[model samples]
Target: MAKNGKKMETQRSVDQEVKAICDIMRRGNCAGAMQYVPELTWILFLRILDEMEEQERQAAEAVGAAFAPSIEAPYRWSDWAAPGSEFRTELFEKGQGNVFAFVNGPAYGEDNKTSLLPYLKNLEKRPNATAKQKVISEVISGVDRVRIDTERNFLDVLDKVDAITSAAIDDTHVFTLSQVYEGLLLKMGEKGNDGGQFFTPREVIRAIVRVIDPSVGETIYDPGCGTGGFLAQAFEYMTGPKNEKIKSADDLSVLKRDTFWGREKDNVVYPIALANLILHGIDKPNLWHGNTLTDQVGYGGLFEGAPPQFDVILSNPPFGGKEGKDAQSKFDYKTGATQVLFLQHVIANLKKKGRCGIVLDEGLLFRTNEDAFVKTKRKLLDDCNVWCIVSLPGGVFTSAGAGVKTNLVFFTKGERTKRIWYYDLTDIKVLKKTPLVSKHFDEFFKLLPKKEESELSWFVDLDERRKKAAAEASPFKKEAERHARAAAQWNEKLKELKKAKPKKAPAIEKAEAKQKAEAKAARLAAGKAKEIEDAVYDLKAVNPNRKPEVDTRTPEDLLDLIEAKGREIAKVLFALRQ
Candidate 1:
């Protein structure tokens, strides 16, 4: 009861903070909360960083280890943003009537000289500056967007931001500020900020994470991690109470600093991702602020001196975006399409036996029109075991304003795929209305490890797929050839008949023409009938012992047989497991 009460109180606090910030954001020439949320995020990040650093200092003292503050005294959150603070008073009330100039402008400080932004930037020169301090400096230097009109208004908003934390009040409900921050990020994505490309649905992220099952020490990465959703979800999955995989504080430390990594190219979106990670408790996130498709040698920050290979990858690279010849030159399968290039990159960068769960556009699934597209699919099958594909329902991404059909493709490198299990999720009603939830994937999760087949899920063996493709292609070519040969014979015979026609009766000529036409029609009908007979034989032959009579089945009858076979296989699998 007490815990429930605390949770309810925290819920109230979260709602209050969001409403307050949004209301304050709309007050002046200031735009909507979407533009201003980043500003609030930056401020909240500093405050959280200071508090986290304090906690670390205490922990170090307890263990008798040497520790120091990341951000030095004067520029720290307590010194600058805390109410009744000295720096706050000096900047706002002391000396001149240049409050806005003091912050937004370049002017005087403690000894009557330094500006706020300039002083923050000067922190970089401090010897032995920690990684946390470096991130703080980087964020502050890029904060030219916080355009509050008055000092009072700024202070009021700052106060509201500060109060969002449980530590700011006398409540025992210690809520994580990351939750509220993520909520704001969700809202921003819903508004189609940055074209809604930077956000993946949380349910989709969770479902992918559950299947991937990232471990504690595994180096998990997202090549195009938008808002760091996959990495964040992976962290939570590994650290959950049921997951005792993380055995030590050292493991926890590694998970915090090194495990989760990503790259974001958009300038507007990079800061949100960075701030998002910081708010999620990563002091030093290994996120590169550049395109993931950039050449590994040219971009050394994330890749280091050599190519980067990871144990697991979760990504939803941008679809329909073009990378021209220059970008295509870096990849083996050169295509202007962004998703195709990302697919090649993911395949190349994954370590042998590394697993990947990627969301790709529908075009990548069946597009064999281009050499690059065919080669990409061929390479995927040749080098990876594409075990499952979950076809996501349309409008799953509509909240983000994307209407393209998407699929979650799961595969592992260094193995040839003999068969691919496909799960058709397009028919689920909840996905169209209530949207996807983890429960929607409950049955999929159960059947996935077993490769169990259901009404919505079926297997397509590579050998069978290849055979089907060849058969489909051969019939068209062969039929066209047969028609051409028959026409040639008819024309040759007609010339001979024309020469002899003067001597023969017109009635006899007409009867011969009718007979020839009927014969040609009969040949075409027989050819089609033979094709249907062959398909039936193949279907029945799947069960080798059953030599059923030659009975031609309709399309519906064929579908029923396939479903029955799937169920029988599923039962056998379950029985064997038992």
Candidate 2:
């Protein structure tokens, strides 16, 4: 009875320890949090495996069944942590290959003779190995005393290991540390590192994600994957358990390793990408360090035959950099070394029917240099579904000290675009002071119309406009003329108003001659004319086109028309002039 109680206590303690570790890992600091318990996992796994083997050996002895030891003696957790003398040093000298060999040999085999020799040897040589061995020995002895069937529910134990190790490092506290590190990096104020240009506003990122709506299991690539924020958001959207009925194991796995890809050129941000991936639960990410626009990695091509075509391509490439002659010469496009190269590269990388969302300077929409580049862009749009253009508010990048107006363009390849949706978010008041927050995105998202519009938004049909332009052969010219005519008519009306004169008072009765007439005769005449006009036409019938017709006529035509009209108008005006 005493032995059973001790075993129960041991099992309960181990279970509790595992739960605590997992909680820590989930909430701990993301960067370098895994470093704290680098070897803790190897030790825990060994102790559990040894206990199982020992149980089988004891059970076989009772049943008179033949048993064999699977693991070697020195490789067991007990051997390493046991009142250690020189075991830790021996493990380190054996290196990684021997460590694996010793761990896999005896305690895990048909014969449980191979000890945890490698682990003991490793602990012996570590700085302060004596202290580490003491603590590890106590922990392992306590774990071994548990007579639980770990195999039936190994996951529970695994969870505990994960939790405890995570807690030991404490990620929640670590995240604060990470923020401090990022603040320091910002304070360093390094340029040409392209830190300012590469850092995409979080609100902008969220907006892009909302518009694109990338689905799970689809390959999402960000060629200029700065700090991996965009990819992280994509992962969160796909993996979020809200859609558990729709999400599957395959979906999660694809998102974890296969579906995501990113490339960053700056060395400073490469580690940031890795750290971000880990924080987002992407254990084995396919991230690379290279200038994706120019590098020949993964898929090598100037334009055709790009590897691993993406379903969604999103990026905020660096702006305002002059490419050198050598760099410019390398590009296939006419723009040579400007940020336009990235635009072209993004287009090239996208799958034929893939969708893309990018943030670019407003000038890219209408720039006249490198006709080939412009023509290429137009051709791409002509063959694709040019969906929406959102003009962002100014001071969006106040933190970066760049006040350039940026726009988000949404387009899909392989579909003929009839109209492009344009959202003028620029007019919306978004900034308050130095640092911009996510509140700006809230209003923009609110005002954004669904596919079937109701209000506050309209579509511009490019296809109809182009067809009309081609039919007329000069629609733009005609439009220009219409504007000019409108301006001329406005000027003529202003000139006539400037030349008009006030009217004189009417003659008074001889008896009332001492009392000057309070009302002018000209005002009475004007009121009478207004009444007649009002009677002739109702308010709704008042002609807006009347001013254009009156102003467009020659000076002689206007004078003749005035003379033909009631002579009271001319008499009153002529007397007032006198």
Candidate 3:
């Protein structure tokens, strides 16, 4: 498919070309990557979409089938942005007699033809508009007008973007245009950017996808698809060289048009995610643009058709995200922690025997102080076989501006977690340049199967630990119940006393309140007893088999070292004074 039988490659990697585009935006009003990327996302999306529609039209024509595009004649990329494009040539006449006038259009003239933005924004209202049309409407729903601030600068951006195409990619590399877009996303998530929450490191996405190993037939979903990374990676894994299961058109069809689904509430992120997956070659991204945990709606048209449950789920929900009471009202275990609520949502949305690999905050793994956190972890263990937990190195998310210690939990529905195999990578320090790479997880992938134990890995028999805790708590629960029964008896006695002698009622009521307080105390004791097991659920991969790093020196030696360091500092001060 290379033009002229010479493989066309971009001037550089896709990232470089995207940078070139952003650089042009920078010359105009778009000052930062955050500002330019969103404006660029829709532009790039429309460009790819037009090419894809052109291909569809060609295919339809080849077979002599009736052909209709999602975006018709004058609005298509070739019709508006290409050199010598008819509508573009007439922009002075069509766009209210000025090119910039069409940016936020009232392109209605004597001819009554709509300009680009108005046409795109009006697609959904057309009679029996397709899903793609509705999606097109929402992707640009947030863009009131062009942000680039001038006609010449915006045209330059289009010219640079127009060069990116399937035909322009190097044939030698197993490539997708999505790789280029990913680089733009990385810039958006770089150390200082405001888009950190939406970005997960690329290596993290790849590792989770490799472990989950989603296949062609299975439906993959991400409840919080930040830029659709999980869904995009899963698509790559299923269709990549490793996966040979895709033998027929139907299999690829299922993967492309029917398999991927997700939900995101942020308006900026929601559209970006849809574009990301589409670039990854997923035809129908099936993404819902709304809060996953709440009833509030943004645009649910694409998501409304997603199956209630999916066969595979992969995601890293936003860490330390906060939700209000309205978001918490839907789940049984109420919590303001976004990660905790997303965990419940993930568990609730998995199909029987379904598999999931999710990134969770390390604090969520270990903290037993929050009742919601503990209950959710317990519910996870009760409902799924959490076969593996990988303790990620510190700064795994530093590149994304998240310095939080994190963990990867792999689980399957339809079974309970008996034991959890843990692989520790905490000792590997990650810096901005030197990040958590695939080689860091080489040992992990090697030891993951058979649940092997090493200095870096170990397993915990959760079933045994819980059994021990339950046995210890059994007597406590029984004693608590006895106290509760006695409290009830006191309540009845107080009632009887009140009926017999009204004057005695206050004193009896005081005694009854004391009994009830004891009962409450006893119940708390029983919960604390059971909580011992839940505390262990803080499954940090602190490998017990590994030798401890002990301070070898005794007190005299330690004191000598401290004095020596103090003397050295004083010596430096003395030299300075002299």
Candidate 4:
């Protein structure tokens, strides 16, 4: 009984270690673990399966039924744990093939020839088998020391993994490792420049999440989901335990399985996003790989393709600056390629009365180019509730070397936009000398306007702005009036000064002129005396008796000495003048 307890305790410790390893991945270190992915995933899957199988076997024994562990004995946890025992050798030491084959499924046989045993045998004989086994064993032992099942829940384990992985990554750590694994795609868009267009800052994601407040059961979508940051945040907001009171179990499940959807143009990041969603525990998300601007994914009457529309849409569309050779040709708003098309896609994807939080460059707010596009955007604003526009500070993407100022525009479809709330945070300090060490978001969040009124934000009526614009026909009238008043004042002053002009020279002028002449004569006499004294004290000219060593000295040396003496005399004269 004591030995059994010790074994169980050891197993519990291993689970904790596994949790810690995964937690490290969650912090953004998965990229470092990329080399170990195949091994780590395989080992972890095996361990989990082993645990599940053990529970099944114990239950079967208790019920008086004959039972056998599905996994072969050689690959069992106990056999693998024997100190210094190389499981790889037993599985594939000679010409034997993959080990995972037999251990993965059933035994190799003529009737069941497709068993995993052959593959496992082959895998053990691979050239790097020893190294692979070592890595696998080390990871297993490391995780084995942690009692994950007893000390932490599954979600907590996932979070720890996410933290670990994210911590390992550099700038791309915003989306947790699970998010990356579950379903967040990152692609190098057009010459790598357009990537920033869809790169959403974490603070921006939080702000959008706060404003949209995505509830359970409501579908959320990002038509231009770059790395799935926005969608992942929405997922967390809806399913996180903090929201349990407000969200029902059924609603949360719906959110996990059916509510989240996204579309991406690049194929590379598609897997990333899918993995991100999966890591977040969303099974089979409705994400698609296509140009949302041109393609349809039929969600409700929102688009031609689907019936269930999204209740919330959050996106940081690529900034419409310039496009490369591989850019999409069918886009009508190709002049402002990225952002304009994404705006249209967002509008098309949103369900009636749906809310949207989008980040756009400030130019979109007042660009005269592309009149039709501008008109469409403005009309959408007018038809909807353009709730707020939070202007973000520059230098948010300083690491990318692009400092384009951006703004978050929140709107709700089918609602009247009588007043638009504007929060001007353009002058806020968002970045420091080191891009990663700044604390701009803290103060910004504090000053953010709640549902209540605040000094940092105010609502401006559209009608009042129109009135102000119309009343400013003669823009320079006030300046012209002020200039005319200043000219009149100058004329009046000139007339008064002319009448007050006066006076003549007196006898003091003659005395002053005589004093000046006497002072000049005295200065001349003193200068002559100083000249005579300098001549008398001139050592180079007076020391004729000290002449020697002329035969040993070169002409150049004599000239240099003469030059040095002349410079010294000049220096004395210059100092006296000062």
For each candidate, what TM-score against the reference? Answer: 0.76, 0.50, 0.88, 0.52
lDDT of 4 by residue, 252-331 (tens): 66766667777776543444454455455554455666656556332211122334567889988777555443343544
On lDDT, the candidate that comes out on top is 3
User: What ranges in model 4 sit over 4 Å off?
Assistant: 1-198, 241-243, 296-308, 321-334, 400-402, 432-455, 468-578
Cα-based lDDT for every prediction: 0.71, 0.53, 0.83, 0.52
What is the C-alpha lDDT profile of model 2 across 441-526, one tens digit per residue?
A: 56556656564332323466666656654545344344444544544554454455445564223312321332222123333444
- TM-score (C-alpha) between model 2 and the true structure: 0.50
Write out the backbone clash pairs for model 3: 92-97
Best candidate (score: TM-score): 3
Instruction: Indicate the worst ten consecutive residues by lDDT in candidate 4.
Output: 536-545
**How would the candidate models be sorted by TM-score, starting from the highest?**
3, 1, 4, 2
Ranking 2 against 3 by lDDT, winner: 3
Off by over 4 Å in 3: 1-14, 84-97, 108-112, 171-175, 241-245, 481-524, 550-578
RMSD of 1: 12.8
Task: Give the Å shift of residue 551 in candidate 2.
Answer: 27
